[model samples]
Target: MEPQKINKGDRNKIYFLVIVIAALIGTNAYLFFKDRKQSERFVTVSAEKDKLRLEVEKIEVELDKVNALNLDLNDKLVEEQKLARVKIEELKASLEKAQITQVELDKANKQINELKTFVKSYNEQIIQLQKDNLFLKNSRDSLQNTLKNISNKASNLENENSSLNAKVKTAAVLKLQSAEIIAFRTKSSGKKVEVTRSSTAEKLSVRFTVIPNEIAEKGHHNIYLRVFDPAGNLLADEGNRFEADGQEMQYSHSIFINYNNDNSTYVIDWANPKPFIKGIYTVILYADGNTMGKAQVELR
Candidate 1:
């Protein structure tokens, strides 16, 4: 009996020890799993923080580029505005110059019309004078015929009248060549003027010829030439002598022959030290105190 009792107590003790060991192992496994989960959460949070930092840096770089581009665009816009302003000013000045030129042109046209009217009046007066002279000749012939029938005293008178009639016919037949402009040629400093893209100083040379009449007298007569710019403003050069006529004229660099000669040519040169812009240029010439011809030239 004593031995049985001791064996039972030993079995109970072993079972109790097995149960306690199982409980201790379960608690240890729970603790280890919780620690591992916390470590994984910490690693995830650290990775997310690093990614956000990189994204911020990229955004900052993009913003800086955008700011730089804006600055460049602003500078370009300002430059464009400045250029536009300058162009506007230039346009205004050109407009004013054009207005003044128009007024001057109108005045010149009026003067030209007046000159034409005067020429017409002169022609009418000459025709009237010729008619009167013819009438007088007829009346003198009748008187001479009557005198011849009466006596021989009209013989010397008839001879004087005949001589006077011959002189009148000779004077009436004298021809005058109308002043005419022949040709216009342009030249630079010493050579022919040419357009170039490069910025350089240049000169303009004008050459004109006068057409003379066959009956022009061989005497000293003054010849005049006038030049105007595209805007109709007088382009007078140095060494030009002013003469009769309501002409604000500058003489060309050279003159060839006097009036009352046959077909003489004249040349004038103007030096422009500034760069010439591309445009149309107009030139006019006058001879014998009248506008004889005109020409147009294009420079590019």
Candidate 2:
């Protein structure tokens, strides 16, 4: 390297070039950070909007369920449902924005809370109406029986001729001689096999036989099946109720069969949508307002 004398003009030019390069680097870094923060904000807003939309969807589903119940909804509930629909549409429109602010998110949350309140009140009213209707029906049925008894006393001698035949019904109740239950699981190819583990079991098959009795009535019979989990909770697709032993009770499944005084086997399948627990399950079958049989199954 040869040592050369540097002029003032050349030194000034070198200083200017260094300053330009530093400025470009600083500007690029600032721009990169700003873009990253903006992207993160957009992602957060999108996630929040998705969560809010799910809440609205839940309310919409509940509304559909109430309407499908076919209950006689009062004026207030109907109006509330109408308001909920309108608000749901409004929220959908608000969430359609590409960028949602904190204020908008808060507002959507508030609206969803109000919609939840409407759904709760709507459900409570439906329950109350169902209970009232059931009570009225039971009372009317009881009164009619009472009136019939009072009016038929004058014909007691005539009724005595059929009393023997009527007494036969008491002995006509169907009784189960043997019952069996099995659990199964389905594979990805849709093949099913018996399973011993609760988590793998998806369905249960129940087979029962009625005891042969010469005096038993021959006609249609309704059999209600109850399956209780290890926690004593009934597993049912829907909370269907029926009268058994003079009381209304929930059933897990139901079957209908015809009896001809001959011992015959019947089969019914129960598919529980939820996962089963590993413990003993109690299954009780009922027919003719009496417990026909009870069986227990334990899973690993």
RMSD of each: 44.3, 37.6
202-226: candidate 2 lDDT, tens digit per residue: 8888888988878876788888999
* lDDT for each residue of candidate 1 in 1-300, tens digit (9 for 90 to 100): 455455788999999999999988998999899999978865765554444334334433433443454332346445543553453344334333422343443443354344345445544554565667778889999998887776665666788788987665444332222222222234545445444322332555555554445544455544444554445555556767664346555754334355544455555555543344455555555444545555555555
Q: Model 1 — which ten-residue stretch has the worst lDDT?
A: 174-183
**Model 2, stretches more than 4 Å misplaced?**
151-300
Best by lDDT: 2
Which candidate tops TM-score? 2
Estimate every model's Cα lDDT from 0 to 1: 0.51, 0.85
How good is model 1 by TM-score? Answer: 0.29
Q: Residue-pair clashes per candidate, as listed?
A: 1, 0
